[model samples]
Target: MTTTTQERPTGTTTEHVDVLIVGAGISGIGAAHHLKERFPGRSFVILDALDARGGTWWTHRYPGVRSDSDLFTFGYRFKPWRGASIATSEEILSYLDEVIADDGLAERIRYRHRVTTASWSSAEHRWTVEGTREDTGESVRLTTDFLWMCQGYYDHDRPYRPQWPGLDRFGGAVVHPQQWPADLETTGKRVVVIGSGATAATLVPALADTAAHVTMLQRSPTFFFARPKTHELAETLRALDVPDDWTHEILRRAYIAEGDEITRMSFEQPDELRELLIESMRPQLPEGFDIDKHFNPSYRPWQQRLALLPDGDMFTAIREGKASVVTDTVDTFTETGIRTSSGEELAADVVVTATGFDLSVFGGVSFAVDGQPVDFPSRVTWRGLMISGVPNMAYVFGYFRASWTLRADLVSEFVCRLLARMQERGATTVVPTLRPQDADMPLRPWAVPENFNSGYVMRSADRMFKQGDREPWIHLREYAEERTALPALDLDDDSLVYR
Candidate 1:
């Protein structure tokens, strides 16, 4: 592992490293830790386009921004979360800071480095990565033996904003939660938040506190699990003087088990699971609150990610008359507010669009393999870690149903193991290849719509890589299965070719 800066003739400086980890978010941090701990001889650097380490957590500053999943699983496997199950953006950032400080990862990260392109040279067995330093506006270049992408799946720069009729004619301020204004005043303001996903669920209840009235307007209903912010087991364990490490492992496994059960129920008995979820919310709402119309969704549970309403705060807001839910289509944006298709007008001074984000493939960086532009959709995923025909590269795309960090940890271990194997084989490059038996396997969309069809995913389906029907060629978003399978994977298998 070596690192040296060289002045290039083109006015850009080039540096070389053993590994180049993109995105200094949770996944990248965990990857860096694993690489340093397992292979201290290797040198690496983490590059993030943002100025901070926490990717989504750093970018999203909307009121009441918090994790939809519990911290036990959402937090890194090696780290113990001492806070409540649901953590706010500030708390999450503090936790990430601890990870960086404790692991000595702060110096290895290059913030404000936006990677623009990655060109892989098969003959050279390396990737030439090019980017610009956002702070200085200087062109930056780097070459690496391996590339690890943990930039996440969304385009942080561009949130999905639906062009509604008469949007330009609206009299008041229209704000997207992604790019929340720091100086925007909501106190005593009539706020109408659009969309029914986790963002809306989080924003409405929060804005209702100061806003004169807040309404969450949605086209359709989405599944939400109203859960307590604190975990009883975690509290009990801490009360009993259990060690943090022990508590963390126990709670992590416990949550994974519960999540696995829910996932199974979603596939095997969706209707039953759906009823259970909705019924749980019924008691929290006012009597005869029209649960069938607002709480119940047409789709089955887990088909899309479920939002977690910590302590049922959203329902409490509604019951307290501070916030309300309106299930209807927006006919158009009126001068003051919005008019529903049912001819009802919602008067608001501020409109918050909590609509979802746009999916970004490989951080929207262009890729070239042997000087030929690589088409992601034309390739297939290998165990959901590495893409076929892409050499010495692995990405972190975590579980949608469970905490994302679970798979990030797993992928870190897998990559370390693969790197060690490559060293033993004296191989400079390794890429996934189709086995003889896999040649005729049917290729499907990265995520099957029936399995998990979030709006952002459906909108970007054509840009994602394909998955095969067989082993070593599919991404089984099951943490339980991947936890065991990834570490025990046979590196000598023919699915991977080493040179």
Candidate 2:
């Protein structure tokens, strides 16, 4: 939320700006636009650690790196994605490029400028943001009334490769999915994909047709399901030859509604959702495949990430004998390949380690309040945007299953409202207290979170910005709920302490 104090504390100078946004991801871009609407005259800038914009999308230039969520919900609210329901990586990249260019925000975003640390000064009523240019190793700093961190969670934009026991024993070239070598060859080689999350699921299927044999190794079973490719509502609209924008909105709304409906059933007891998923999956299995052990997951639906189709998804690859799932943890890495707990050594020429991403807070930057370390993990968030203790800063988090743009769109609206209100009141800055003596706030995760994927969920819930447990504080995934919540603009903040 954009809020500044009317009184700028004595003794502050250099680059006097109203807001300083860190990270040029979608969230940061969205914040800039809203801030413009709220206070057009104020000086603001978005700094990126990398030399380009688009945050994760811009940074992650790996092979077959497309968004898992549908494109309709993924695009910004003000702007629309006028093409395919499921967009490709290149297409999504184009869309982002178009948005930035159209908005005339390319200049506002200083690429290769990364924020290293943010220290709030209560006496000065400003935040001192330190950044560096990785390429030139040049240091730059900014002091602004408010700071916003739209940088995403993944700390290691590089990849997470564990020291597998006897890993050096394997003479084969190992590759992390994050940093897939473009020039390296993987064709006709036996490939083993370690780790069983969305990344692993997408990576395995995409490689099956080319690789001699692709084996998926998992420590435990994770929920696997299909993302419906085309909806009936979308098809009908397309038959009418409606404009892409009109059809996109229709499909976006339908997907969101359907996704929320299905996701709400994610936590049902006795695993009803899991049972139904299994029942549907059983029909597609080969005649002799074990139903309970091979496919059936011990965890409930959404406990693990629901895998999507890289190329017609998991079933087609399995049915065609291009891919296989093995439920065993890796004991160690051998020169030849991986050694499983079952004492089975899989032969591999190329090993693709699709192990997950590293978790980071504020994009791996130190968060300080009044020059004191702001332990966000211990703070309860207000409206999933602002922390209770840190008054003016907002961390951008996206939806779990729904279109990330949906939540981001709402955040834009709320931030605009906050800025307008502050401007009207002549408030130059504001900071919320992270420590609430009266509130007993349980910690939570941020991102497209589901209770099912405990591994991923466990990492995100507590450290990321979270929703308030009470009515407006809770982030509602439903389309209708979000429709009302976002763009509402009226934040009743009896609890928000403004200085």
Candidate 3:
């Protein structure tokens, strides 16, 4: 919230920083905390595109949005999650603010600063990051010894949209969920929600309560189930005199293990579990409702993300005639309404395009070395954190398995170890190995992409690391196991050699 407003020196090496964090989100903020704790004398600055500091938690100001996971595991290890399970977006933001206040990170953050392009300087052994301020249009360039990219995978510029054949001709108001117009009222209006993912599922039920009529349209279905909002064992463990942190770690592991088992057994033993899932839903569906159309997904479990509800009921809303799910593709957006492949034109006054997000390579920002473009795609992942060829840069990637904060926590802790290692060996820079492009690489769209930007990651597959058998990266799902496997506190990994 505060900064040293001295003019940055131009055409010369100005401020000297030990590390430059390119985000003010949970990951970047967490990284800064770790760095300060490990090396108090080291100078580091956390930059964010928006004026706020919570990153994605700051950007997504949508309604009915809350942590799908528990707050205990979703929050940072350095900070305790004092709230109950499944915190609202506002609660999460307030908690983030508290984290900032408690850690004295206000002065360390630079707001309204969006990084444009980052190029490394091989001669000076530093990264030259460029970003412009949204308010005054002033630009700031900073060179640092190390770079930490926690900006996430989505791009806010171009909202993710599928090739809806007639989007330009849609007469009714069409809105992407990412940029949901604040003032637009859906009250008593016929609203159609596209997609069956978390966004669509959550939006449909939430909107149905207010809208005159609500319909959820999806080309493919998801294995939807109502989940318990609270965990009894977790509650018991917390009250059993177990360390809050230890209980958090254990519960995190149990949840991850449970999800992994469910997913693993689905693929490893599909018929039995699939039947159980179907049996549970069959009794709840309405008489005229088709379960196969909305609940049956084309892909197997874990291929696409699953929707969660604590109350064990999203179907009740549909059963009550408040909402309806249609498993048909939106053939086109005609003048009057959305035309489905079944030739059914659902009349609507407003359309909520909860289609998905545009996947970008780290917030649609580019990287470079010595002012030259940093071709980061030509590298293989090392421990899913560092690349073999890129030096002194680490990316916090939380793919489908676990909660995002989990890996971000690990990355933050590992960054602390990395800084200590650099100091111990007297190394000015740490670069991961950037190998030549692998000809045989099978690119899969595994991680959630933020925007629809053209990038190598969009054209890739899950080569990073799997989460044993779950959604986000499998290995880092459990905090306890992750604590043991991540970067050593002493920076003792032999794989990390100082140049």
lDDT of 1 by residue, 371-397 (tens): 899999999999999999999999999
Candidate 2, residues 185-237, lDDT tens digits: the string is 77898988887777776777777878898888877766666655665667787
For model 1, the superposed segments whose C-alpha errors exceed 4 Å read none
Write candidate 3's Cα lDDT for 262-332 as tens digits. 76665577676666777778877788567777787655555556677556446878888888888788778
- Better structure of 2 and 3 per lDDT: 2
For all predicted structures, in order, the TM-scores are 0.98, 0.88, 0.85
lDDT of each: 0.93, 0.70, 0.69
Which stretches of candidate 3 lie above 4 Å from their native place? 1-13, 233-250, 434-484, 487-497
Q: Order the numbered candidates by lDDT, best leading.
A: 1, 2, 3
What clash pairs does model 1 have?
A: none
What's the number of clashes in each of the models?
0, 35, 41
Best by TM-score: 1
Worst 10 residues of 1 by lDDT: 476-485
